[model samples]
Target: MSLGASDHRAIQPDNDDIESRIEAETLARMHKQLEDRRSFLQRTTSRRSSVCIYRVPPSLTEVSANTIAPEIVSIGPYHRDRDTVLKFENYKWSFLDYVLSFTRRNGNDLDKIIRSMSDLERSADATLISSADFVEMMILDSCFILGYMYLYTSQEDEPTFSIPIVTRDLLKLENQTPFFILEMMYDLMKTINGDSLELLALKFFNLKLPRRDEEILKSTYTPPYSDQSIQCVTLLQRSGIKIRRVKANSFREINFKKATLQIPSIAINDYTTTLFINCIALERCTPHIRTHFSAYIAFMSCLINSTRDVTLLGQDGIITSFSQDDQDILFLVGIQTVIVILKHIA
Candidate 1:
């Protein structure tokens, strides 16, 4: 009954063949998994690098999520479906209708608008949740923005929402369609005469802040620390450093020379806070953009530690606070967490 040597040899060859096949199959699966991971990484890197619009980071939201959220109207996909924002949806449609009526164009104009927005789909923030109808949302939001700007500049009838509140809402980081979309809608509608969309926007906001042709940002630049902690404005004064307002158009033109810190006088109000916070968020999300706002904010936060600092800055005309409560100014500029975040980002 015992097997002969030749039979045993034959069985050994069969076992060797099975083991080789099993190893080959396992190696094939391993190679496939490696390829899949590389593909996933490539896609993610491409999306992250090119994305401009982004949802506010959770680190920032932890301070105050509502700071970046739209109050009156949601202009982008991030908050379009919220119950509070849904009420304003009807107004957007009304604005679209007004455009159609004014232009003497019918559904064909609407179709053209949809097609144009659709072409820019790739530019939408990759981090955003996919909208059911992104083109429709873009058209409606752009129309609302253009219509509001027109109403604001003309001073016709008062809009349903207060002008300042709506302006703040429109500028929210999460509540923005691309500026190009606004321009496209404006051109298609032919609603305004003899004014570019950029001019209309500048007029609508009435911003004194001037635009720079080029912003030189040294991303590798690190702040020189004299001590473990940055001194507040009062402390800086005690150290024989004079702080005063300079006649500069841009707030970013801050300079320190011969112990004198010269900063452009900036208005601090609810609207100003909204603008600053949105600009900071934009810079944070899009790394390629200049971090002027974030750096400015971190520097301001370090300078204004208490009400005394705010008072000193105000007396010097470095800060013009529209808010009656000095504590509000303190809260606006004393965000220590933001300093940490900005430092890490830098």
Candidate 2:
């Protein structure tokens, strides 16, 4: 209040110095935050378009890991480190040897396969391993699949591995290489194999659902949604809604016509439970894909509640159970346990 001109001049410089220091600190923090944000955005967008393989979400695994986990073989990076699957390493190498023998390209087939997969490493989400290891994994896994499919389709003596269990393991969401990888490998060895990869796979899995061309034309991939209250199988049957088998190409081709709930016949086996669970997991992880599989499972869960429902479905050939025990059949289709996880995704 009583300061001289010299005192004012000294205070002004101090104030200016403090303001400059504050401004520099604020700008530095802003730059750091922006840089961090930019790096995060780039990392996320880089993998979004190409990421196809995924581990089962912990929420799902918490419900039942047995259904989601691979038992015998681990095909891709997600479960590659499993000790249970590691025992099959030699078998994969054996299959790779078998594959090379058919190539007739003087050891060039492997080189070509590895090179092709190396090019795909970027798009195939190769962060789980080194670039060399990723390509190697792709090559070995692809050969094993093709070799197995070849032996399976050709009926060239039964495979050393249990056909059903290995088949089931191969379908696990975590235990898969990209289909295109297998296709490219097969193209190189197709001269020795008689069928296309699609045909071979369908035959190997025995997924031949009888389909009418006209019914396939009528098939829709939309999830079935209803505003009406859902009813159990017994209640629906009591209400005179007949459940009949509709031969269609896709499981999502469910329809109602003339008081008949026409659903495609589905085999409820040891594999059925795991198969649908993995499919649901895939749908949940990949949001762009429709949740038809999850919706269908949820719809089926709604319909199947009691042994009587399972019996009725079996009588109609809508559900053919490979297991003899009623409880096992119930466990496979009741799969209401999956409904808990589906609620989140569906």
TM-score of every model versus the real structure: 0.70, 0.71
In order, candidate lDDTs are 0.73, 0.75
- Candidate 1 residue runs with Cα over 4 Å from true position: 1-52, 101-108, 115-133, 154-162, 190-196, 208-230, 322-325, 332-336
In angstroms, the error of model 2 at 45 is 6.5
- Model 2 residue 338 lDDT score: 58
In candidate 1, which residue pairs clash?
A: none
What local lDDT score does residue 193 receive in model 2, on the 0 to 100 scale? Answer: 52
Error of 2 at 229 (Å): 2.5
lDDT by residue (tens digit), candidate 1, 1-346: 9999998887776777889999999999999999999999999887555434567766666566667888879987778778878888888898888776654553446666666777777656534555447777877888888887887666655456545677888778878777777777777766546778877787666533444424211133424332256689999999999998998646777889989999889888777777877777777777786667677777787898888898899999988955556776765553557657666777
TM-score of 2: 0.71
RMSD of each: 7.7, 7.6
Candidate 2, run of 10 with poorest lDDT: 207-216
The alpha-carbon lDDT assigned to residue 27 of candidate 1 equals 100
Q: What TM value does model 1 have?
A: 0.70
Q: Cα lDDT for residue 78, model 2?
A: 83
